[model samples]
Target: MKEGNGLQIPAGMRDLLPGVACDQRQLESRCTGLFTSWGYQEVITPTLEYLDAITIDTGEEIRDHLFQLFDRQGKILALRPEMTTPIARVVATRLRGAALPLRLCYAANVFRYEEPQAGRQREIAQAGVEMIGAATPLADAEVIALAVEAIKQSGLEDFQISLGQIEIFNGLMEELPLTVEQKSKVRTLVAKKDFVSLEELLNSYGITGAPADRILQLPTLHGGAEVLEQAAWLGVNDRARQGLENLRQVYQALASFGVSDFVALDLGVLRGFDYYTGIVFEGYTVGLGFPICGGGRYDNLLGQLGYPCPATGFALGLDRILLALARTNPPARATSAVYLIGGDDTAAMLNKATQLRSQGLSVEIDVLGRDEASLQAYAQTRGITQVQYCRQGG
Candidate 1:
């Protein structure tokens, strides 16, 4: 292997220049503000947590994706693969004594060791919220509705939320005669929407009849409220029926919130996490093959952390959202920047810059002492429009 220059970043990471950085910051601001307006106080968790703590209920896949390191005491510390687990830990310990249904939000970066591609990265910047101690369809609906609004607030209008209840699938599985390994394989196939393989696997087990039929029909059971009616006609078990009813209540609540237009009933939807006990959803926008945001009701995660409370939340991939926006509406290169070109009087330039900053303007003073031509050239290259000269006397 040949050694290269030091300018190269890791494969999964890239440098975000000024304009892109601005866009990311703006997106974060808009989302955090919306979260605050919805009465969700911002919470910050450490970037790294104990490997055991982070891997609480996360399955083998997520555990394998963790970027782990050993600390001084030889304890394994891993960069958090996601925020929900850490927030659950926080609720279990710090916020344990706090009020019920804690509405907390966060905007931070997470790490996961993966074969990075377009949306999936080694370092992911995300923002999301968690509502602790609430275990109702209304709570699920609330989070789903908020996710819709958050995506809209990010200037993404052409998006849809695929909503599903894991219990529906669990309910269907309850009636099936299969070993634990078989069930795990079925879940993997369903999550992948690999109907062909799923059918073959089920047929090999001699699992026929209504339950098998429903399992096969799960992925196709997506669309409007009528999908629910179709699922009901499938003669599902008690648990499946309960999940359908829960989906109905959530749909009604979303309608009440005026966000039902963005939601669709997806009975086959299953999140990757093992903690989801009820509603799970993923948000997709036009032009993006993968979901830009996802989360669900994890009524059991807090219990795993010893908190024992029902919680629900979602996280939006800031990078993916920006990518979607860029595809739809490319950010303008030109920025509203005012460059204060100073002559001999650096103090006057500083004072003017301060004054403009006080008036909420993005002002920059010429620290390099560039001449008029050079300053204008630099400003033009940087997409800076406004340029003012600060002389010695002024």
Candidate 2:
């Protein structure tokens, strides 16, 4: 890249100008408001942390995406590629003894070093909530319900939260007659949804009958509630069945909580983070090709940080959400009612402006030296609600 590129920022980063910034804040506010109402307080973690601390539970894929550097003292450091890890660190160290079932939320920017593409950014804005110390299906249901409500509140329609349980997969892998390496390979293939490759893999392993059939069946087992029933009878093992039952309870509870219409069961829904020991899910809409929101149960994450507690949470990407909203219901330009008065009438304008501001109205004194007719035209063009002439000496 040339130095003459006119104040160029690195690739995968862009500025959020006025209009989009307004929408971004509105989106963040709505999410944080919903979190606050649910008693989840917000936390802001630093953008940089000791590299090892950030990479504790996140897998190699996530670590590879981190932008790493060395500090003056030669200690390795990284810009946080995701927000949850930072939050988990704090919960384990700082808020460990604060309380049981800590409810926390944050709207913050995260950085990554990855090839930029649609719905992806090097610097992304995220609004998320994490509930710590709660370990039950209801806690899972709470986060999922909040997620649905958040999308609904954002004015997004036709989005679905595909819920899956890592325990089901874990249980099945434990029962499979495959090598340790083979099990990891199966997980990778299934997560990618590469059925052909998965089939080839199973065939190569000399696996047949129900084990092979069930493995292939997973990536496509998404639909109405019946899928849960089908999962319950997959015959994998006691552990898998127990996990499926737990998932079923959470799904049904979400229905009773009134957000079922926006959720579906998908056995193949695997989140990349290995810390997720139980249910996981991602939110998707019609037009956008990526999940706008995602999260799951990470019962072991805090323990790795020396804060042993069960937790669940999810994060919505503000930029992708804005894109989804734009594709679906493109927001109208944000507007406020304002009356612009002409000329320099500081005393009177100040008094009037003060009164209008006090009343929660937008008022502006003409600083452009625009004449009465020109001022009226300017106000009209700018959608100023009213226009008046404030003679200079009056």
How would you encode candidate 1's per-residue C-alpha lDDT over 301-353 as one tens digit per residue? Answer: 98888768989999999999999999999877556575544555788778888
> Positional deviation of 257 in candidate 1, in angstroms?
0.3
TM-scores, each model vs. reference: 0.95, 0.94
In model 2, which regions exceed 4 Å deviation?
A: 177-182, 335-337
lDDT of 2: 0.87
Q: State, as a TM-score between 0 and 1, how close model 1 is to the true structure.
A: 0.95
Query: Which stretches in model 1 have alpha-carbon errors above 4 Å?
Result: 1-6
lDDT of 1 at 82: 96
RMSD of each: 1.9, 2.0
Encode model 2's per-residue lDDT on 232-303: one tens digit a residue: 657478778888888888998898899888898998988888789899999999988789999999999999
